[model samples]
Target: MNIKQSIAIIALLAATVWFWQTQPARPAPRVSFKTIKGANITPADLKGKPVLVTFWATDCPGCIEEIPHLIELHRQYSQAGLTIIAVAMHYDPPNHVLAMAEAKQLPYAVALDPSGSLAQNFGNVQLTPTTFLLDRNGRIVMQKVGVFDLRDMRQRLQAID
Candidate 1:
């Protein structure tokens, strides 16, 4: 092959490899944060329990829309060894977060990540209602970036225990 053709082929191969390597990795990011309830939670806490860590915001319609589903998921799966954590973002103040949790009658544990600590740790959180499903070992299994369908979520829960 001519030198020019050889170089072109090598460049093409390199680009292909780069693109393949840049794809998102399976198992979501790991982030640890304190719950608004003053509970110091870490990935370690989830080591023996299947954990659903959901990132949400009060202003996001999609996030608000999923509350009932989340509550239901917790109620349904609690006996099955599932832990549902609602991590509300946008530091709306501790009292406000508590009040909202109370108003919603949120069945699962709820926390406010006002400092963005959890979100930043989770990586690339560009939308509300980002949900991470972690296995009993605290390893991320699924990362859903938008609203989750209840039926699909229920099925995923079933896969846990």
Candidate 2:
């Protein structure tokens, strides 16, 4: 190969390697928030229980679309030591959360993070319906950005228990 071609190939390889290494590890950000039922929910509180933290906005279509699956997952897994804690990052007021939850008929425990503290803590949460699957030891195992798959979430929970 010509000198220029050889140099270009080497540069491309180096860039690819750098990009691969620089990718942020999946689900590293540990998040904690308060439950609407006047309880403190944190990583330490979830020890020995597989926890699913879902960040959702009431206005997002993806978030709204996944509500039924989320509800079913909670009903099926709650008895199995799996805890689903939903943190709402919707910009609307707290009353809006209640209204939305009531309208959606969501029975799972949910919390309002009005300041978007939980979302911000996990990183830039510009996307709606971001979820993190955490093992029994409170370590994040996987992160779903748009829509969460109940099957995948169940598999992760099985890994812990």
- In candidate 1, which residue ranges exceed 4 Å CA deviation? 1-31
In angstroms, give how far residue 82 of model 2 lies from its true place: 0.9
Candidate 2 residue lDDT tens string, 1-161 = 99999999999988885564345445445556776677777766677887777888777899888899888888888898888887888485777778888888787778888787778877666677888777776666776677867787667667667
Query: Which lDDT values do the candidates have, in the order given?
Result: 0.78, 0.76
Off by over 4 Å in 2: 1-31
Colliding pairs, model 1: none
How much does candidate 1 score in TM-score? 0.76
Query: What digit string (tens of lDDT, one per residue) describes model 1 on residues 13-73?
Result: 8887556434443554556667766787776666688888888877778988999998888
